[model samples]
Structures are given as C-alpha cells and as structure tokens.
Target: MKNSIAFSRRSLLALTAGVLLTGCEQNTFVPPPPRVVEVAHPVQKTFTRYLETTGNLAPINTVDLVARVQGFLQSINYKDGAFVKQGASLFTIEPQTYELQLEQARAAEAGGQATLKQAQLDFQRQATLVQKDDVAQSTLDVSTATRDNAQASRRQAELNAKIAEINYGYTNVAAPFDGIVSNHLVSVGELVGVGSPTQLATIVALDPIYVNFNVNEQDVLRIRDVMRRRGMTADDLNQVPVEVGLQTDIGYPHKGKLDYVSPSLNQSTGTLAARGVFSNPDHALLPGFYVRVRVPFDKQDALLVPDVALGSDQAGRYVLVVNNDNLVEQRKVAAGPREGDLRVIESGLSPDDRVITAGLLRAIPGQKVDPQLRKIDVSE
Candidate 1:
C-alpha cells in the first residue's frame, strides 16, 4: 500500500506540471498579419507642360459710328444688325440745303471769274497805253493793282466752292470698314449732329477675333525663365501658340497665336495682360464671351504617379514608396499639376520607384508589407 501511494503522488505531480505548461502556452502573445498594399512603378513619359488660364473674347476691331456734319437725319440706309461692306452707306443727312449752298458757291465763283476777266482786259489795255506813253504811270499802276486784287478774289471764290462740295459729300454717312452694324441710334428725320457729334451706330468686325487674358506676375516670370533657357527673345513670345475653348466646350478646340504681351506688369492687379488672335471664320467666338486658354511652353520626360498614392501633412505633399525589399518608405514629393487621374511627380520620385497607390492606411512607414503589384493607366 505504501509503494502504490508513492507512485500515485508522482503521477499527480506530473499531471499538475503538464496543466501549468498548457496554461502558459495559451497565454503567450502572437503578432498580427503583415499589411497589404497596392503598389505601382512610376511612369515615365514625354509630358507637355501647359499653362492654363481663363479669358474673355474680344473683337479685333470695334468702332462707334458718329455723325460728322450737322443736319436732319434723312434715312437709315442699312438694316439693323446686318453685315455691311466698307464704304456702304449707313445713314443720310439732308442734302438739299448743302446742295443749295453749293449752287450759290458756284454762282459766286462764276461772278468772280467774270470780274477777274474784266480786270485782265483792263490791265492789258493799260499796259499797251503805258508802252505808247498815252496813259499816266500812276493810272497804269492803279490798273495793275486792281487786276491783282481781282485775281485774289477769284482764287478765294474757288476755295469756297470746294468747301461747299465737301460739305455736300459729308451729308451721306458711310461705313469705315467691313463689319456688322448695330441698330441706328437716331431715327429718320431726327435732328442729328446738333451741337455735339451724334451717336449714329456701332460696328464690330467678326472674323479673326481677339482673346484677352491676364497672367499673374509669378507665372509671367516663370515663362520668361523658360524662354531664356531656350534662347528666345521678347519678340518670340508672340510666336507662342495658344489654344482656347468656349465655356460650353470640353477642351481647347480653337487654335491661335499669341500676338501681344504686356511690356510691364499692372501695378494694381500684379498681372500682365496678354492677347491671342484666332481665325474665327464661322463667327462662333463672340466678344464678351468667356473662354479657356492653354499655352504649351515645354516638353520633357517626367515621372507620373497615381494621385491616390499622394498624402499631405504639415510638410506639404508626400507619397509612400516601396523599396526593393518590400519595405514601406514615406517620401516627401514635389508634385505638379494633375494629369487626369495621375499627378506629376516633379522631383521626389524616380521612374523605377514603386509607389503605394491603395491600402495606404494599412501600411506603416518602416514596416514590411505584402505589396500587390498593379499597373497604373498613364493615359487616364
């Protein structure tokens, strides 16, 4: 009985030890699973750098027509809003009074010519009498003076006739250019050109429209720097090509050339005024309409990454990159304008670097990750 009791105690101690070891094993800690992240290599391509801005459409030429002479407006020769050719009659002032004045001027001119002819005849007779010593020298001198005064009067009368003719021509108002004319400001038979030059109509050229825009000083300086690197002169700025789109249009569809750049920045707005000329043959672009302008200045090979890979902090913009060993690394990046779904990686990333595009929250910097390689649509 003593031997059997000793054997049972040993078995109980072994069972107790086994139970304690099992409890310790159950309490031991196990680490969580590794994070999963979608990764992609940065895309390299020849990217075109475009400066986009907004502007307003303007006419190449706009003029407000005004009467040049005083008269009652006889008639409006043009239909309202009609396209007219250069020198087409637009309005008519009363020509009867001008014509009558012209007739009186001609009659005065005729009388002057008759008086001049009589004076010439008298001077010729006096010269003959003086040569023959049949007339007094003082009398011959008086005849010469009278003839000279009559000649002066005849010339003055001729000038007065020309003035009358010009006044008569001014009665008919004509268009200064080929353009669309606005509605007549003065109705027929209304007194026009009274006291002040009366507003008659307005004209605007349709084809080859102008687009006006303003660029900030910073952008202007950047563009100048770019031109300097290319050895371009100030004259070459007008050669830069520009593209424009209307508010309803999707992309820049109308192509144009930059023909104007301000010599100095505006002090009030800190912007430089610029203009582009577009051949708007269809008259699709009208003055005062809003438009989008894009100026392409340079092209270069650049690294592009998915926009989802970017993150922002107090340090500005940053992106997560996976190293060759599949370790997550946070890199601060210099990002540029967005190109579709991708953002331009201006400085920070290399073409071969793998960027974490998804599951970024699951991945921690300095930690290992199961990076699932994926392709980014650079075209997007």
Candidate 2:
C-alpha cells in the first residue's frame, strides 16, 4: 500500500514538469520584428532636372576641295592639316597648258579686233561710194555685208578669250573659307583632274562648333507648348534658347542656343534633328565626339523622395510612410521626372511625411514600428 502511493506521487510530478517545459519552448521560438529607419520630407522647389542623350559634335561648315579644270597637279600649295584663310591657295595644277590656251585666245581676239576696225572703215567708204556714184550699188552692198560678218566674228572671239581667262584661274585651287584642311590626297606631282571622283582634301570650320542630336517628335510638341506657356513671341526663340549637355562632363560646360530644329519629323527615325550652337573658341568641344545633352523646361515645385525611399509592389508604386503614432501607412504615389536619384512626386504625399526606405521588407500597412531617422550617403 505504501509502494502504490509513492508511484502515484512520481507520476504527478513528471506530468507537471512536461507542461512547464512545453510553455518555455513556445516562448523561446517566437521572433521579434526588425528595426527600420526613415526620413521626413520638407517641401521645397528644385529647378534641376535634365533630359539626357548621346550627341555628336560637328563643324559649322564642312567643304570638299575639288578641281574645276582638268590638269596635272603641279604643286600642293598649303601644308597638310594647315589652317587656311578664305581665298588661300591650297593646290596648283599645271598652269602651262591653260596659260597657252589663254595666250592663243588673246592673240585670236587681237587679230579679230584689227579686222573689226578695218571693217568699220570699209563700211563707211562703201556708203560714200554709193552716194557719190563712184561704185555700183551691187559693189557697195557686197562691201557692207563683208564688214558685218567681220564684226560678228570679232565679238565671238572676245567671248572665247574671256572664257579662257576663267579656265586659267581654275588651275589654282583656292580655299573657300576659313577652316582647318585635311591631309592631302595626292602628292605634289600626282595627277588630279576630272577623272578623280573624290575631292583632293576636305576643310572643316571648327570655331563656334555645333552639336547635333535627335529628339522624339512627341517631345517636339511638348517643347512648343513650353514656349507658348512662357509667353514667347515669334522672335523670342531667337533671343532665349535651350541649354545642352555633354557626356564628356557630368553637366553642360556652358549654355547654348537652339539653332536648328528640323521642319519635319524623320520618317525612318520618327524623330526630329535638333542642333545647338556653342562658341568653341578654346576648341574644347571637338568634332565627331559623342556627348549627352540636357535641356531645362521650367521651374516647378513638387513633393519628391530619394529613390531609396520607395518600393515597387504588384499595385504599381507605394511607400511605407510613418504617421505621428509610428504606424506604417502604405501610400500610393504618382511619380514624375527623376532628378538624379530622387523622384518628384506628382501627388499622394504631404510635407514632413516620414518614409521607411532601409527596412522596407519589415514594414506592413497599419503595423507599429520604431522610427529611426537617417541621411543618405552623399559619397555616391
């Protein structure tokens, strides 16, 4: 009877221990939520959003040097890659052949002039002869006709000589404008004539360089709307202009004017070409360089947030905004132009709203969280 009583007591003790141990295991297995940081948004206006693109640089003027008259290249007048002034001689062809032609034409013209003078005198004599009856009517008529024929021949010869003079000048290849010339295609003694299809060299005007880029036709309509919104007159675009950017640097070095926008959209590209002219007296902007361009529209004030402070959901875009009670409120936002890494909010956010960025995954709508404020790393 004593043994039975002891066994019942042991069983009861084991049951109590098992129940206490089960409760402790459940408590130890539960995980606490993660901590998150956020920042308060201050309402302010910022003016610097840029339209980016890759553009190519080019000279304002490009010319191909061609020989007007057929002749053997006698000499290269200018050094290869030399800067030439307008009307500077670049090459010289064999002038001997053209010179001979000119001389022969001049001699023919002189002989014709002498013949014309004699004809004038003979016509006068013939008129006098018919009136004084010193010669027959038929004889006077014959002399007059001969004088007229000689006069016509002299005029033709004078025209031929003038043409010859022009051909002689063509033997010297003169620069068309002030520019840098390319390397010589033919040596001094090489043959350069009508048979040669390409130009002997090329010249490009580098000063006051131009940058060319393309923009979508849809953007064209928007630009025009901006111009009208600014109360711009027809002449205003000539005075006020758009600025450009370069990939060589992070931002545009200097401002430029919108010089050209294509009248019609390119059919193949479905875009229009735009050109901006900038003074490149320092030659800092070289020709044929690919660059990025930025143009500002107008200043506007809007709610904005750093890219890090936002999250993408199946329901478009939303952010975990913190309320005064530190509760996470999922607010849907309309995004606008991205200025650097920040997004301009078009709607759905107010001033001084704290947004959770770093620990976004740890947040849920209506969940309470510990709000820690932090700044973005500025080194990037």
Q: Give all candidate RMSDs, comma-separated.
A: 4.4, 5.8
Give the lowest summed-lDDT range of ten residues in model 2.
Answer: 42-51
Error of 2 at 40 (Å): 3.3
Per-residue lDDT of model 2, residues 75-191, tens digit only: 888888888899998988889999999999999999999998998898899899899999899987888888888889898899999999998998888888888899988777776
Task: Give TM-scores for every candidate, taking all chains together and pairing residue i with residue i.
Answer: 0.79, 0.74
Which 10-residue window of candidate 1 scores lowest in summed lDDT? 371-380
In candidate 2, which residue pairs clash? Answer: 247-292
**Candidate topping TM-score:** 1
Give all candidates' CA lDDT scores.
0.91, 0.78
**How many residue pairs clash per model?**
0, 1
Mind giving the per-residue lDDT tens digits that candidate 1 earns over 223-341? 88888889999888888999999888977889999989888889999999999999987889999999999999888888999888899999999999899888899999999987888
